[model samples]
Structures are given as C-alpha cells and as structure tokens.
Target: MTYKYILPIDTKNVSLEMIGGKGKSLARMASSRMSVPSGFYLTTSAYKDFVQKNNLQKDILNLAKPEIIGRTVSFESASKHIQELINGVELSDEIVNEIKQAYGALNGQNPAVAVRSSANAEDLPDLSFAGQQDTYLNVRGEEALITAIRDCWASLWTPRAISYRHQMGIKQEVVAMAVVVQIMVPSDVSGILFTANPVTGERSEIIVNSSFGLGEAVVGGQVTPDSYVVDRKTFTVKESIIGPKAQKIISSDKQGTILQDVSEHERSQSSLSDKSLKELTSIALNIEQTFEGVPQDIEWAISHGKLWMLQSRPITNLPPQPIEVSWEPTPPAKILARRQIVENIPDPVCPLFEELYLTKGLETPAKGQSRKSFFVGGGPMFVTV
Candidate 1:
C-alpha cells in the first residue's frame, strides 16, 4: 500500500509542501547529521484526506471567513465550532492503519511519543508561528496518539490561527497541517538555545534556558528556567542564574508526564552542569552554522547525557545586528502599520482613498475625545488609535 499519509522526518527527499515547515527543518538538520530525534511526519496529504473524507472544507472555509458570514459567531464561538466539527469526524480505515503501522515501527507495542503540529504557513523567517498550534509531549499508546493528531489538526483552525492567517492575507483553503510524531526523549535536562542574543541581537553571544525534567516548563513559561549567556567563539559562560524551579513535569507510565512538587534540596542547585551547558551551547552554534549561518531559535533536550535537537528555525523578528550600519532606528512616529502590514497586503491600495479617508482629523462623540483611525494601507482594514 502507498504510504502517502506518513513520511520519515530525517529524509532529504521530501518537499516542504508535504511535511510543512517544522518537518522540513527537522529533515534538514537530520540531513546535516545533527542530533535530531527519530520521527515521522504525517504529510499535508493526511490533513487533506481527513477534510475531504468528511466534506469539511466548505464548512470550515466559510466559517473561517473574516467577514463572519455563516451562523455569524464571534471568533471564540467560531473556533469552538470548527474544532468541534474536526473532532466529531471519523477517520478513514486507511489513515488509521497507516498511523498504527508507523507507530509500530517506532516501538514494538505502545511507546511514548511527542505529537506536534507542523503547519505550511508557519516557521517563516519574518513571522513566528511556533506555539500557535498544539503539541502533545509524552503521549503514550496508539489511541492517545490518534487523539493528539486530531487535536493538532483542530488547532489549525483555532481563533488565533484563523486571525493570524486572515490578517496576514494567507488563504485558509491554501493552508494545511502536518502532524509530527517523535520518540519522547527522557530528558534529565532540557532547554532552549538562541544562537544570537535575543535581547540585543548580538551574534557573539548565545542564550540558553535550562530546567529540570521536560523543557515544556521553560518553553511554556510554567516556571522560570535557569538562564545562561555563553560566548559564541570561545564557548565560555559569561552569566548564569538558577531559577526557582519549585516544580517539574516528569513522565508517568499511565498518564504521560505529570507535574509534581520539587524537593527543597534540589531547588538551589543549578539544573545544568557546567559541562552540559557548554556542550549544549556548542551544539547550538553548530546548528546555527548548519542553517547557513542564520541566527537560530532552537529547542533541545538531553536524554542520558546525550543532546537531541527537538526543533530549529530562523529567529523571526530579530533586530539588525549591532555591528551592521545599513540603517538607523526610526524616531517615534504615528505610522498606522509597519512592514508586516506592507508585506501582508496582497493587493495595491487605492490612490484616491489614501489622501481623503484615514488621513486623520476626526471628531468623537465625547466632549474631550477625538476619534483617529489608522489603516494598514489604503484599505478598509483600520485600527482605532
């Protein structure tokens, strides 16, 4: 049988169109021999298959329209409705069989895995869609895995996601979600690494956030992670702070990972050893080089002291490097929208409307208040300031 639904993550042969951005990046790193975990990606074909099988495309598309046409619900209501629609649909036997077969290849029976969302519209160099979709870590068994995949698909139509796409001018019909399933790393220490300093845009320094148990505590902002600043060239630690990790999430046999209180003794000590910190930084630098020297925002974990790359993508919305002198910062101004709006507008704005409407100087209903409208372009999409 042809396996159009599922494809291996590490292969260099598949296209981004199939596996989506997150899957393609993982494939790229795996190709470069980076320490990426073994995984499989359920391709966009799978999402299309599910949608087509249930005749869901039309209903979802109409609901997703920014104009709020059918049933006329608020964003929250629309999100709930769309998610309910997806969750209620039955999966095809072929799709279910392929998913089970893929999981069986990973482990003999049921094994813990990470089911993550991979969307075609995310992971762009300029836009950050990292956490907009759902991710289920430490998921166990076939039934749970199936449920996670369905949830990941439902996340594609979430209110935030729908708003993001509409505002960015991405067509709802053109987008699809690919679910990524990977062996769950039994992490002793897990964290995030930024190749370039996120605060000052200094390429010479790498920022690392480390914590106990799973990295989700750090990534999800559930707890304050131990922070570190390491020099890029020398691989020397410059700064460190041990966060108050009073609790952590650890894997459980019956219910995936569970959050429990930490011992008073373990709270004061550093979550990462000096050696581990240096090593994670080194691997992060290597990842930066692997991505053609672009600054990278990487997710990482260490299982049995072996480092693994969970995900990596270009650092979106990074400021210009301090050394670069191509342009200077603009002073505070009353511009309506910035580059995101410019790039998002697919069509040209009308010349006539640009001068007359949205040019400012409007009155308000209140005695002291004046109404001002700021537009994304010369379009009807306006923001009240």
Candidate 2:
C-alpha cells in the first residue's frame, strides 16, 4: 500500500530530495538485496507539509537570518527558538495515522526501533553533516515514534547543525529533514567500518572498530573499541589493537538506551573474532564496490552471527592516496639532504621547475663571471652528488 508520507525501506525510484541522503542510501542498499534491517522513511515531503501547515518557514528563516547576516547572534538561542517552533506544533492526524500504520507493518506491535535524522544536505561527498542531527534509539510505541519523529525534525535546528549549515553555505529554507525508522538490531557486537584507512589514507586498507553491545558505545566514544586494520585485497587482518572494552550501551526494557559495565574477564577480551573480522572486511569491500569504488564510512552490527548494515556514507575529508616516496636522490644527485637551497623548499619540487631553475638557471654563472670566479665572488656553489 502506498502512503503519502511513508515509503518502505526497499522502495525503488527514491531520490535524495524525497528521502534525504540516509534514506536514499538505505533504500539503494535494501533494493540491492543487502542485509539491511526492515524500515520505512518518513519522507522530506512529510517534514515540508508539517512545516507548511504549522506556518513555520517564515519564523525559521527569520531566526536563521542573523547567522546569515554575520551578526553576533547566539546560535543556541536561535536554534532553541526554531526547534521549539517545530516541536511545539502538532503533526496532522493524517500524517500521524500513516506513521502508526507504517510502524505496525514494519515489525508488528510497537517494535523497538531507531529513528534517525536524514537531512537533504547531509552525507554528500563534500558536505557530511554527520552526527549534526538527532537519532533516537530504542524508541517504541506509536506515540513515542511520533514524538521521536518530531524531535528528529527539530534536531535540524541544533546549534551545531545550524552553525555547520551556515559554514557550508546551505540556505535555511532550502533544506528539509527525512527520518529513517529501522527495527533496532539487538547487536551482540557492533561498530564502524571504513572502506579506506581514514587515518593514513590508504585506499587498500579497511579499518574496523568493534565493541560489545549496541554501536552507540563505539560511535559515541563511550568506550574504546577494538581496532582492526584489514587488507582490502586479501581480506586479511593486517593489524589489531584490542581495546579495554570496559563498558557497553544497550537498550533499556522500556525506552532509550543504557550504558552498562562489562565484567572484568570480558573487558580484556577482543570483541570480534578473526572470522568475524574477515566477514566484515568482505562486506566492506562489497559496499565499496556498490558505491562505485568510493571509500565508505559504514555502520554495521552483528546479531546472532549475522551481519546487518545500518548505514553507509562517503568518507568525507578523506585524504588522497599516499604517494610512495624514495628518500634516495635520483641520478647524479645521490645525496639528499635538507641543506642550503633545499632548506627553503618544503614541498617536493616539480620536474618543470627543476629543469628550468635547478638544472639550468642555477648551474649557469652570471654573464661576466667564470665558474671559479662565481664561487669566489660570494656566489654559493651548489654541489649535486
């Protein structure tokens, strides 16, 4: 059944404008038969309609104007006002009923789920407004889901999010929020996977951070997760650093999440086995391939030994592939030292500059001077070995 505000997780023909970045990516992955959890998207159209009905555009724009005009206005104050305007307004009954129906279809009666913000401007190759908006985990029941949805919309006006958008030059009126409602995976082990090594910018390496329980412990920095660097080609673990794994985050019986302390024995142990690491690496490689070889920042979970993809986005601000450098000088210049002329040159010299200046211009003495005279007359002689 088609709904005005909701689309199934595996819906085809979804665009970033309609479902926002997160929703679109999830839909793509789901349609591709990836092991993504069942979910639905509260489309950006829903957010727009809510705002229009509540007459919030003018007020939201006006509040955000100070930031645009370069005034010394408090972002916190403006964000608070805008968020209040959004949260205080009642969502239409039509939209609420649609959400209830979708939620029911997703996992039967009041299933525990995650409500994530998916702004239209988020998770792009250039602009990754990651963690800029809210994500409510372990949200249950129709009323709670509705409240979470509204709060997700409000999170768009968070102080950090507002400042980030202002910095990114994203217009206030142009952006809209979509919410991803996914069944909560009671992950035994969960963490993040970088299809590329984000630290050293090695495209051939995949990095994984694994921790016990829900991924929030790893993602939120509540605990230092076990780190594994795997060879992308071989799907082998190149390095592993076991973290303390002191604590883990889990969903509460009622609602929200809980941070619990791990037992002494468990704290010292590795969160993931070698087999699981290989499996994760394989999945990461597949995801990278799916996104046309673009390095991905993926969120994943393992429940009962099965892998589930929560989210995957382009790894923004990733450095270029590391260039292999030979310290030994080429040809006649066997000795390479940061001395004399080389002292001022911080970066590697280009071949053109080297040919035009170092090889020719520097080698030639002044018009009236001989080689010996050039050296003796205060002209420093460059020695190329």
Candidate 3:
C-alpha cells in the first residue's frame, strides 16, 4: 500500500495541492534560504486517509447542507455536527506512527510547536481565509502535538469556515486540510508584516504590527499593537504609532500558554526597534520580489534578537496603488468618484461588522451600487465626487 508523505519544512518536492498553501509557502521560504522555524508538514493525504478510514465523507457532506432562514443561508447545525464528527475520528496506524517518528526527530522529548491549519481552499486570489481556521500554540509533547493536529483538521469544519465555503459555493466533500507543525519560537516580540500598506493601498510602503510575547495577542485582537510604516525604497521607518498594550500571551512550563498582565512601564514601550524594523522590511521585500512583486503578508517572530519568517502569503484584494510618486487630481470635464472608504477603519473588516454594519444597515440601494467593502481607510471622512 502506498502511504502518505510526511515532508519537512525545507522540502522542495511538494506543491500547494499536496501540503496546502501555508505549508507550501513555508516550505518554499525555507528552501529559498529564508529563516523559518524548523518544522514539518503533514500533507493533506493524511486528512484524506483519516476521513476515508473513518468513512466520514457522507456524514460531513450531509452536515454541510445549508438551510435558508428568514433572509439568508445558515449552517449552524451542519457546522457543529461536522466538527464533532471530525474531532471524534481516529487516524490510521500508518499515519499515526509516521507522525510520532517525525515528532521525535523534531527535537527529542516535548518540543514546543505551533500547529496551524492549512486548507487546500485557502489563500486563493479572490478569497483570503487568513484566520478562519484554528492554530494551537505552544503545544508540547507528542500527545499535545497530535491533539493540536486533530484540532486543525477539525477547524476545517468550523462554523465560520463552513459558512465561508458555503457562500463561495465550494463543496464540502472536496475540501481537504493539511497541518503545519513548526517549532515554537519563544519570541520577545512576534507580529505580522504587510509588504504593501494594507490600509492605504500604498505599495511603496510596508506596515509592521508588533506586540509583546506570542503573535496571537496581535493577530487575535487581544492587544492593539504598535504600528510602524516603512518606506519600501529607502527602508526607512516612515511612521510609528505606539499602542497601549495592557496584556501579553506567554508560554509557561506549567501552563502551555498563559496571559499575563503587562506592567505599567512596558505598556507604553514600542515592541520593535528601528533596526529590527529595517531587518524585517528587507526580508519582506525579498519575499515580495520572490512572488513577482505582488505584495505579501508575512508573519515573523524575534527570538535571541534574531528575526525568523514564519509564513508568507500574497496580499489579497488590495486597491490599485499609485503608479507615480507625484500625480494630479481628476480632470475638469468628468466628475471623479473614489471607490474607497475614508476613515480609520481597521484592516480586514470583522465578520460581524461586515454582515451587520456594512451589509445590513448601511447599504444604499437608491444609488444602484451595493457596498463592496468600499476601499476602507480614514481621511477627512469626505466623499470626493
């Protein structure tokens, strides 16, 4: 019998279809000499095999049928059922033994890891499933790693994920998941770097968001991180905004991950230094170049005062950026209309706000234009028509 493959992070033989987008990207980065944390990829074949052995496809697909409520499709029941089924299933002996051996080779006993879900359907040009699935951090030991991997597989059936796939008209039976298990970085600071300015659509600038401890604090909205904008050309720190960080997420031997209150003195400090910011920018720029200058969203962690690239994906659905540094306003004959929101709205509108605020209440049917996430940002709160 042909068995599934357990590939290392530096493997160059696998494609995105095999390991899923996140794993493929990380593997590519590692192969290209990028400083990624040592880890391995559990290919989608594992997930497929588990589903096949447990005979879960029919049950999962049945649970994915969308029900029309008062005005829209809802799959709350389907999502819960599918997730329970996924989590309850057991893996085959072949895959389980391979995973155990790989885990042992990672770093002996109880190596801390971050198990992240990498769905085959994610990171598409039109869709950005950035954080729809689960990520278990600071996972130590073989049992914890296995549990985390199972959780990631189950996250493929999460409520938000189900709804997203449903709206996108993707069949549940076709969706498969891979898990990326990386050696955990005990980071002094961890955060994300956008090669292009995600907010202002400035391709010439890069944005960095950093906070204390694990990046979950920054990514989970648990803390407002210090934001830094860097000039792409000169690699200069163009702007910096300090955020009030009230707490931090750190790892403890006793508890895998524990939240500790930030001290009064540390709350006001910037998480990243100018030097580290420059280093991060250079790395991000390199990644963007590797992807043919299409902007990238990268995750990084700083440990032992050195920066490591965790993952990199294309920046999806950015507005057209300015071609020239200096340009003129609209010509007199035609009235100009900017298709963007001019306010300090956050990047990637929250799901609740998108469904409730942006979609339900604020739409103006009279204008004959549905609100399509109007180029969101802040500037005078004025519509230039």
Candidate 4:
C-alpha cells in the first residue's frame, strides 16, 4: 500500500507508526479542537524514503550494533558517523516541494516555525524518551526549515539516543523519525503543566513551571522558573514560588535563537497571571480527559494573551497513586523510627518480601521453630524490613 509522505496536523486517523508518538498526539489534539499551533507532520514515510533512497540503512544499523553487543565501537563514534551519513544526503525533490508547499500554507512570508523530532519509540507509557532528540525553534524560510528537518532526522542517532534505545532493548532498525513543523508562538510567557504532581505523585495537584520569553529556558533547564501548585478539584493555587527570572531565550533576527537577560523589574514577578493559571489548569484537565484519563505532561505558551498547547505526552515514571493509609503503628511496635538497617533500605518493601519475612519468618516462626521472642510488623511511618 502507498502512503503519503506528508499529512495535515489535524488528520484524525494518523497512527503512532505513521507519524511517531509526538506527531500522533499533536494530530489528535488539533482534531479535538485544542489550542494547538498550526502545523503539519512530515510523516515517518518521508524519513524512511530518504533513508532508503540514500542507502544509509545498512551502514546505520551496522554502526548501531556495536552499542548493543559488547563491542569496542564507542557510542560517540557510531553516533557521529551515522549522523554525518544522514546529514550529508540530499532529500528527494518531491519531499522538498511538499515541505515548501506546506510551509507556504501557513500565515505570512517565511513564517518562523519550530521543527521537532517525533520518534516512533518515544513518548510511550513506559518509556518516555524525553529530550532524546532535537527540536529547532524559530526556523524561517525553506532552506532553514529543510536543514532543521534533516538535523532532526540525524538526531535519532545521537549518542544518548543510541545508548537509551540499546538499554531499553528497542531495536534500532525499527525506529523512524517524523517531524512536527508548527508556526512559532512568540511566547511572552511559556512553561510546562503537569496534570498530576510528578514529585509527590498526587493526582489532585497540577504543577506549573513558568518563565519569560520562549519555553526553551524552562524546558532546557537554563533557568529556574516560577512554580505554582494548584489543587485539581478546587482549581485553587495551593503554593506559588517565584523563581529568579534570570535570562531567557528568544529568536534572533538573522536566524536561529539567542539568549537575553530579563529586566530587573520583570525578574521578580510571576510569569503567568491568576486567570491564566486557572485557564491553563482547566485546559490541562481537559487534555488529561481526552487521553483517556492518563496523567499528562503538557507544554504550554501564552502569545498575546492567548494560550497554545505545544505538546502533551503521558507522564512517565509517575509515582503510584496516593492512598489514605493511617500512620498509627500496628501491634507490638510502639514507635517507628529509621535505625541503621532501615536507613539502608530506602524504598518501601514489596508485599511479597513483607509477607515472607515480617509475617512468616518473624511473626509465625517456621514449622518446628518455637514462637519468636520478638515479633516484627510493618508500619507506614518507617521501613521495618
């Protein structure tokens, strides 16, 4: 069957295989009438076509094999060689024309856009693969956009990406890169919003991290952003901590991006207003619902007082749901404290271990053994095991 190499952002039937994880999510969001920026997906078919036409697949896979086996071929060497091979190839004229046509459809002449990598193996429920590739922001004109797209493709072979895929047991040959090209939002305020508290794992809390200028400062860990924790049920701000605004990233006139310092007056102020926070929270909740109630890590921006959804993915490594377990000590144990051995055992003991050790071994003595002089039981306040 033949598939088009390009698809409009709102194409509802786009699958993870066709457009990769981020592209599929963006398409879904756009179709659902979320405030997503206008964009198009350069589908994985395009990437495969490029690779096949250039005959780089075999060489690339051969280079990747060393990382999985115990071969001496260093990750840096393999990544560098593979990326250079991809970057040196020329994209087909058909692909170039399609990209140009799509770019022209956006508003204005040479509109700046963000070109992001969307890999088939990324943004999964169990494997996040976050920040494993490249995202070129504020790319303008056909040449720059095309370069950014090629760079995004090459980023699939970055050292970290190669090592991560190997560690996760993901076959390198099965992975393909799709690109998300969206009109840049000249964000005066940008940040990330989590539907659930990533740190505390509280499903009832929404965490917002905001900063001035583009979101790169916050997303790239260039600055400590203003943090606000909002109660999900009541939609009220629980805690707001203002960060030192410091420096921010913005687009350069010639091309690419540059950093600038925030004025002293604005440095001490919150990046988002109260009303904006409420609106962001509501939108985040709706997005969570749209994804079948899976907690989301959403990237958002405010341009000219309007909010835009940049990206959303299932929050990875989220802590288990909070429960209402009482802290009172159980039988024989008067108080629970972290002694030497307890300190060594950091995490809570699994149920199986507790049952075998604390219940059977300590409390009920095995077979012919007599009743223990002291019984051991678990308490929520301490790690007894």
For each candidate, what TM-score against the reference?
A: 0.81, 0.86, 0.82, 0.84
Tally clashes: model 1: 0
Taking the tens digit of each residue's C-alpha lDDT, what string does model 3 give over 57-135?
A: 9888877888888987887788788889988777777888888888788875778888899999997767889889998
In model 4, where do residues sit more than 4 Å from their true spots?
1-3, 67-73, 327-385
Query: Candidate 2 residues 1-385, lDDT tens each?
Result: 7799999999998789999999988998899889999989999999999999889999998987444345665588798899889978899998999999999887668899999999999999998888889999999899999999999999989988888888778888899999999999999999999998898899989999999999988888989999998888888789989899999999999999998999989878889988888988897788888889899999999999999999999999999999996444434444333446645544566666665565565557678874321111112223443
Tens digits of lDDT, candidate 1, 283-376: 8878888889999999999889898999999988787688753422223234433444445555545756555652442223357765444443
lDDT of 1: 0.83
Q: Give Cα distance to truth, residue 350, candidate 4, Å.
A: 19
Tally clashes: model 4. 0
In model 3, the runs with Cα more than 4 Å from the true position are 1-3, 323-385
The better candidate by TM-score, 1 or 2, is 2
Task: Quote model 4's TM-score.
Answer: 0.84
By lDDT, highest first, what's the ranking? 4, 2, 1, 3
Q: Any residue pairs clashing in model 4, and if so which?
A: none
- lDDT-best of 1 and 3: 1
Q: Ten-residue segment with the worst summed lDDT in candidate 2? A: 372-381
Q: Largest lDDT belongs to which candidate?
A: 4
For model 2, the local distance difference test gives 0.86
The CA lDDT of each predicted structure is 0.83, 0.86, 0.82, 0.88
